[model samples]
Target chain A: MATIITKEQQEKEKMVTLVSSDSEKFVVEQKVAEKSHVIKMVMNCCGIESPIPVRRVKGDILKSILEYCEKHSKGEAQEVMEKWDKEYMDKAEKDLVFFHDLMLASHFLHIQELVDLIAVTFAGMLKMKSPEEIRQKFNINNDLTKEQEEHIMTTFGWAFQPI
Target chain B: MEVCGVPPEQDKTKGFSINDNADLLAEILSRLDGRSLGVAACVCRLWSGVCRRDTVWEALCTRHVSGGAATARAVVAALGGYRRLYRLCMGPVLERLPPARRDEAGHVSLSLSLSLSLFSIDCYERLGGRQRSSLLFLRNTVDVS
Candidate 1:
C-alpha cells in the first residue's frame, strides 16, 4: 500500500515566498526566511500565506541575504559556518558598493547576526589604520575646516597617538 | 543637534548608504580601539558625531577602566560626558604609549585637569558677579599652564 502524506506534514514543510523590490521572487524554507526579524514579523501578522515583499532591498542584495539565511538556518558545524562566513564576507567586501548595499539590506531587515558580521569586518579594516588610510578606503571627503580639525586634534590629540 | 557650528570649508562628498547612517557607522566605529576611533572622528564631521557618542566611550570604559566605578567619575560624566570621563581615566598607563604618545598623554592629562577646574568655575558662576572674574582666572590659568 502507498503511504498518504497528511495536510499537516505538507504544512510543516511549507516554504515562504519572498518578493524583492525589483520583482524577483524567492521561495525559501520558512526557517531561512524567518532569519530576518522583519520577515518573521510579517509572516506572523499575515499568516505566511501571501508572498511577502522586501521592498527596500533590491534583487541581488536580497538574494545574497537569503543565501546567508539559508546557510545559517541549516544548523551547520561552527567551524564550517565560520569558514563559510569568512569567505562570504571576503568576497562581499571586494566591491564596496555591494558591501554597502549588503550592510543596508541586512540592517533594514533587522538581521542582527548579519549586521554584526558586516560591522566586525568593517571594524577589522579600520583597526590601527591612520585617518588618511581610512579616508582612502571609504573615499570620504573631509568636511571640517583646517582650523576645526586642528583644534579637535589638539583637544583630543592623545587619542590619535599610536599606542 | 548640529555636529559643528561652522559650515563646511571643503567640498563635501555626499557619501550615502552606510557612511551617512549613524547606527551603521557606530556599529563599525564602536568596535575600533581608541586610535582608530580617533582617526575616524577626523574622517569627517558626521563620523565625529558618531564616534564621540557616550555609549561608544562607555563600551571602551568598561574594557579599559580598572578598579571600581566611582561616584566622582559620574560627576565628570554629567558635565563633559563619558568621552571626557574616559579621557580623564585613560590619561595614565605610560607603559603602553609610544614616546610621542607619552608626551600627548601628559598634555591631555594637563588639559583634563584644566577641564576639571572648569567645574569649580561653574560653581562660582552660580554665586554671581564672580563669573567674569572666574572666566578671566580660567583663561589666565590655562594660558599660564
Candidate 2:
C-alpha cells in the first residue's frame, strides 16, 4: 500500500506584500518571495514592518517572476527543478521582447536567478552569430569605418573561418 | 563636455546607441562562452569596443580553458597567464614545433608532423596571421626535425 503525506505545515504559515512602481500591489507567500535574495535581505533587516517596494518591476513581470519563485521555492526534487527551469527558459525564448523587458525588470529588482537565466539565453543567441548577423537580429546599426572593419577581421581572424 | 548637448544632423535612426542599453547588453553578453563572445565582437565597432573590454575577454578565457589540461598548459605558455592572452581560438597556433629535440636525420619527417600539431594549439590561441615566413620556418623545421 502507498503511504500518503500531507503538505508541509510550515509552507502555509506566512505572507508578505510587494508594491510596484505604479502602486500596483501583490500579496505573496513569504516563502516564495524569500527565494529572491533581495527580498530576503530586506525582510531580515526590516523584520516584516513594511511592505517591500520593488519600484521598477511591473505587475505582469512580477507575476511571472513570482510564479518562478513559487515553483522553485518548493525545494522539490532536484530533477523536477531542472526540468522546470528548462521549460521556463524554453518558453521565455519564444517572446524575445518580453524576455528582454523582463531582463531589465529582473535586474532592477535584483533577482539574480531570473537575471542570470535571461542573460544565458541572450548569450546563446549571440554565441554563433557574426557581427553582421547580430546587427541584423537585434536591429543594431553598423557604423564602423573600412579601417575599423579590417582591424576587427585581422584581430579576430579565428572566428572568421571556423563558423 | 556638456551633458545632453547635441550637434544638429545627429540622426536618431543611425542605430541603437551603445549607451542606451549598455548595462543590459553587458549583463547579457557576460553569460556567453568565449568563442561566441569573440564572434559577437566582429559584429561592428560598437560591439567590437564592448568585446575588447578586458572583463569580457577574461570571462571568455576562464570558460574556454576551464578543464582541459593540455589546452590550458599550451595556452598559458603561449599567452603568459590568461591575462596576456588576447584571442586564443584562431588557426595559426597549430603551425609547427619540431618533434625531435636534437637529431636531424631519418626521423626528420615524423618530427615535423608532430611539431606542426603542437604549433596548431598556439596558432589557434593567438588568432591567425598571414606570416608565411613563420609558417615556412615551421614547415622547414618540421621537415628537418
Candidate 3:
C-alpha cells in the first residue's frame, strides 16, 4: 500500500517567496504569508507563481512581520502565543524607528491584527508621558502656537490637573 | 523629557518618519483614551489635529460607552459630534443636567428640554435594553440629565 497525500495537504505545505523592497527574499509557508490580507489578495488573483514583491516594506521590517505572521498561523495555545507576541513587541519597542517601519508595513499589508497590536504598543509608550516627553521621544516638533497650546490646556484642564 | 533612558536612535535605515504618516499616526492615537488623548493633543500641531478628528473621538466613545456600537452611533448622532458626546458622557453628570430654576409663582420649573432630555432618555432606554453589564457604568453616570 502507498501513502497518499491530498491536494489540500500539499497546498498547506506550499512555499511563497516574498521579496522585500531592498531585494531581500523570504521564503515562507503559503498560509503564513497569507496572514497578510494584501498578500492573500495578490496570491488569490495571481496564483502565487512568482515572488511577490512587497514594495513598501523594507527587508528587516518585512522579516519581522513575516515572523509574526508565521507564529500566529501556527495555531498555538493562547497563553503561549500571547507570551510570544509580548516578547516580540517588547523587542520591537526597543527601537522606535523599527517599530514605526513595522507599523507602516502592517498597515500597508492590511494586517488588521498586527496593526492593532502595534497601535496598542505605540499607545502604551505614549501613555502617562507628558507632551514634551512624547514629543522628544518621537522626535515630534511642536508646531502649535502659544495661543493654541493655552487653549488646549484650558480646554482639557482636568486632564492636566493633578488628581 | 525622555521617558526611557536611551534616546531613540536617528533613523539611518529608514528615511521616513512615522509622525509624518497620517494613517499610522491616527491608528496609534485611536488606541488612546480620553485623558491620554487630551495629553496627546498637546504633543504637536499634527497630533492635535489628529486627536481632534471626530473619527478618533468616535472610536473612543464607542469603545468606552455602554450599549453596542449601534447604540453608541445613535448617541453620538444625537449629540452634535463625538467630542460633544464624549464630554457629555465622560464629564460630570451635574454639568450635563438642566439647571434647576424656581418660578416667580413659587413653583419649580420642570420644562422638558429637547437635547439633553431626549438624549438622556434615548441613551438610558437603549443602554438598559442591551442588558450589558458595562452599560451599568454609563447608566450610573447618566440619569435623565
Candidate 4:
C-alpha cells in the first residue's frame, strides 16, 4: 500500500525562526525548533511566522542548543547520539561559566534531555572530586560553621575516603 | 498559552553560577549518587540545603531502592538510618565503607549529633504508624557492629 503525504504532514517540515538575546537570527526546521517545549508551545499557539525571541539565551548558547536539537531530531541511532552527547559535553565542560549558562538556557527552554545531559555531565565531574576540590572547582564559599562542617565530616566521612 | 516572544532579558552580570538557583542546583545534584551527594553537601550552604531536601533523597530512594513507593518514603522518613532498606537494590552503604573501622561505622545512636543529621529520626516519627520503637531501632543500628 502506498502511503500518502498530506498537506498537514508537509507543514511539519516547515521552517521557524528564532532570535537570540543579542538579536542573532536562527532559521531552523519546525521539528528542530520544537525540541524546546517553550518554543513548541508558542509556535502551536501563535504560529511560527514571526521569529520567536529567546530573550534570555545568548547567541552562543542558543546556537549550541539548536545544534543539539538538530542532531537529536535526525532520529539517529542510540550509540551515535550517546557518542555525540559525550563529545558535546566534552566541549561544554572546559569552561564552567559557559557550561552554567548553557544549563540555564536548557532549563529555561524546558529541554529536559539537554538539562539531564548537562546535569549528568556536571555530576560526573564532581563524582571523583573531594570536598576541597569541588569547592575550588565551582568557586563555592565554605559557608558551614566549624561545628556544622565537623558534623558533616563525622557522618559522611566515609564518602571522602579513596576507594 | 500564547507566547510568541519570551520576556526581555534582564540586566544581569556576565557571571552566571548554578549555585545561585536552588532549582537549577537541585537538577544537577539530583543526578549524583548518595556518596557524591555527601561530598556535595560539604561544598557550601546552598549545596547542603539542596542536598538535604526530602525530594532529593526521595528521588534517590525511588531510583536506588525497591519495595515500592511506601518503602522509598519510609527510607526517606528514616533518612539514612535504615541502611539495610536499600541493600537489595543499591548494594548498601555498608558494603562500600572500608571494613577497617567496621565497629565505628553507621552507629546512629540516640545521640544529639545523630539528631542534627538530615537523616535524623524526625522523618520516621513523622511516618507515625511505622512502628519506630526506640529500643528496637537503636539496637538495630548496632547490628553491624
lDDT of 3 by residue, B41-81 (tens): 89888888898788887776555433345644665666467
Candidate with more favorable, higher DockQ: 1 or 2: 1
- Chain A of model 1 scored by TM-score: 0.90
Local error of candidate 2 at A115, Å?
1.9
Model 4 vs. true fold: TM: 0.70
In the range B1-145, model 2's lDDT, one tens digit per residue, is 6788454333332433333677777777676655566677777666777776765654444432323434444545554433234333211222222423222333333443333344564456446654443432433424435
Per-residue error for B91 in candidate 3, Å, reads 5.3
- Candidate 2 segments whose C-alpha is farther than 4 A from its true place: A1-13, B1-19, B64-86, B89-145
Give one digit per residue, the lDDT tens place, for model 3 in A20-97. 999999999999999999999999998776899999898999999999999999999999998999999999988777
- TM (chain A) per model: 0.90, 0.81, 0.90, 0.88
Which pairs clash in the backbone of model 3? none
**Full-model lDDT, candidate 2:** 0.63
TM-score of chain A of 2: 0.81
- Between prediction 1 and prediction 4, the one with superior DockQ is 4
Determine which window of 10 residues in candidate 2 chain B has minimal summed lDDT: B88-97
Which stretches of candidate 3 lie above 4 Å from their native place? Answer: A1-13, B1-16, B65-67, B91-145
Taking the tens digit of each residue's C-alpha lDDT, what string does model 1 give over A1-163? 1234666656655788889999999999898999999998898888667789888898999999999999999999999999999999999897677788899899999999999999889888887777788887777777889997997798668876644
User: What would the per-residue lDDT of candidate 4 be over residues A1-163, giving only the tens digit for each residue?
Assistant: 1234666556644988999999999999999999999999999998978889999999999999999999999999999999999999999887778889999999999999999999889888888688898876676678899998888777566556654
